[model samples]
Target: MDERFNVELEQLLQDRGRDFLSLSGVCKVMPSALRARLGLKSNSRVGEVQKALQPHMGRNLEIRKAGRSLCLVRRGEKDEMLLRSVQARPGKSPKTLRNSLPFTAAEFLRLTNSLLKEGRLRVELNARCEPLLFAVSPEGPPTLQPQPLALAPVPDAEAEKAVLRAAFQELEQGRIFVRICDLRRRLGWSREAFDSALARLRRERTVQLHSGDVSAMTQEELQDSFVDENGFRMLSLTWTEAR
Candidate 1:
């Protein structure tokens, strides 16, 4: 039982590529998904198993017991790790590159975008029209570069209103958070437009972006999170009274 649960939890962390998770999140998810039934008798045992597994995780990725949560402790700078990954596996989709390390999706996006901005890396479209990341070195293919984002455009007020209304209804339903990915799918707006609106609302303090428990979300849901300058994916959206 421990083996299966442990592997599942580790994969959840890895698939989401985040550096931190809460024990509350772990306990909530493990039982629900695996139907582990975590009877009151089993909670303490689960904690102990997680603790014993910590040392082993430290080899590739380390986990430390931090109060009521688990946090990944990695050595190198994230940008350095990203460069190495791109060097090893060039021409990979953004999702592939994002999941290549122990950093959070937001962290990956920030550093990757930083590197791209610094000309340390490049992205090219593959045959399937998917963006692929490549190290910008002498050996890298000499391909035309895509246009970079200079600024987050001023958001359309209408689009911002729509996002607010959707979030409000969800909040009124007593849900603590709304998944950005779900909103994206429902809105059917261009990524650029949606991203810009999120940025605007965040800047105006109309909304606050928070990371959901990685354990509660699928890999695609995690990847679909909004990353607007913060170094972690905003998987869940909460609203402010001002909105």
Candidate 2:
């Protein structure tokens, strides 16, 4: 049973970007549409999940018990732990991320500034005009500062469109929907400019944005999502005709 649980848990973790996950999905065992494939029924008294997660704790993951809903978050350096959280579930606001981390507000702020300066982390706004953090590099510290977000000149309307198209062309590679984060990096635009342009195009219905399985995405891919004021998240975009 332990071996089986480990196998199932490992795959589930991989599918979820090896970052964070909820036991609600995998807490039950047995054939049912309602249950996640990785089954570990803690209620059964036969297969308690905490015991299953025991072997993995302190190695690569941590068991974060929040109320009755048990969550598994990545375990690593303080920097990496925070990065994974922001990358996986940025939530609706910056405060959301801060609330979730194991740091005080002041400590979180200091860490945020350090990561931002090192270019391993990033901040951007969504359609709802909320600020969120993203991990530019998932692992170690970034080797150099990325100046494009800070140094790039804001493009004019026509220029923004042209560059956006160019970015899409470069990143899509024939996919119907391309990851928004990749496009943003390719365009080398500041977060403000990128979000504004994307919002404009979305509002005009020139581009259709879509969300995907967060577990199946990398940290950078997860953070590059486009969320709106209603807290709706869009991770990729597709377009047919636009001005």
Candidate 3:
């Protein structure tokens, strides 16, 4: 009887230890800071971190790669509530959605994009020419607003160029070659609009598209593009040489 009790106690302690580790790992903290606190080696790979976090996977915790680092985020009760709220209304601007929820802009974007990639969410343009998000469901009615609500005039060519330019500048600031899907999300452009703008840029030699390889492409080859299974199309904006 004493041996059994000791064995049960040992199991209980191990379970408690795992719970503590998982809770600490999921704190809303910076990756580097969390690594330091957890005493993880500085050169730990993402896969290593994920292996260390295996016990926490799918238990209201998720790991995400943010830039070059991995971060832990919670998908707990609050996140479920947020999803339900968005599903109920089914078409809100990102700003509006952010305001309605407790997430920061970055967090909102991350969560929404994840859902979109998973086909749990969809996006459409509203009458105001702003992107709105909706939840996906088989039995539900189409999420788009009726034709009556699309009374706002379409933006002119200059307006479209301005928007595209703004998006390009933002990408330049990040100093990273952006994926086409991510760029479209950043610019809030529908698929049609994004493709049209990109074709125009290619024609003008203002941007270069790449495949998995990041090497510079000649102007003639910019028109050819491919999207990977994960929906990434490497893109870089080009600058004219000043003499």
Top-TM-score candidate index = 2
Tens digit of per-residue lDDT, candidate 1, span 96-127: 55553556667777998999998989877633
lDDT of 3 at 173: 62
Question: Considering only N, C-alpha and C atoms within 3 Å, which residue pairs clash in candidate 2?
Answer: 15-215, 16-215, 128-229
TM-score of each: 0.37, 0.51, 0.35
Which tens-of-lDDT digit does each residue in 119-221 have in candidate 3? 7777777555677777777677655332222223236865666566655565666564555543554554444556776766666666666656433332112
In the order shown, the candidates' Cα RMSDs to the true structure are 11.2, 7.7, 13.8
Clashes of each: 1, 3, 0
TM-score of 2: 0.51
For candidate 1, what is the TM-score?
0.37
After superposing all C-alphas onto the true structure, candidate 3 shows an RMSD in angstroms of 13.8
Best-first order by lDDT = 2, 1, 3
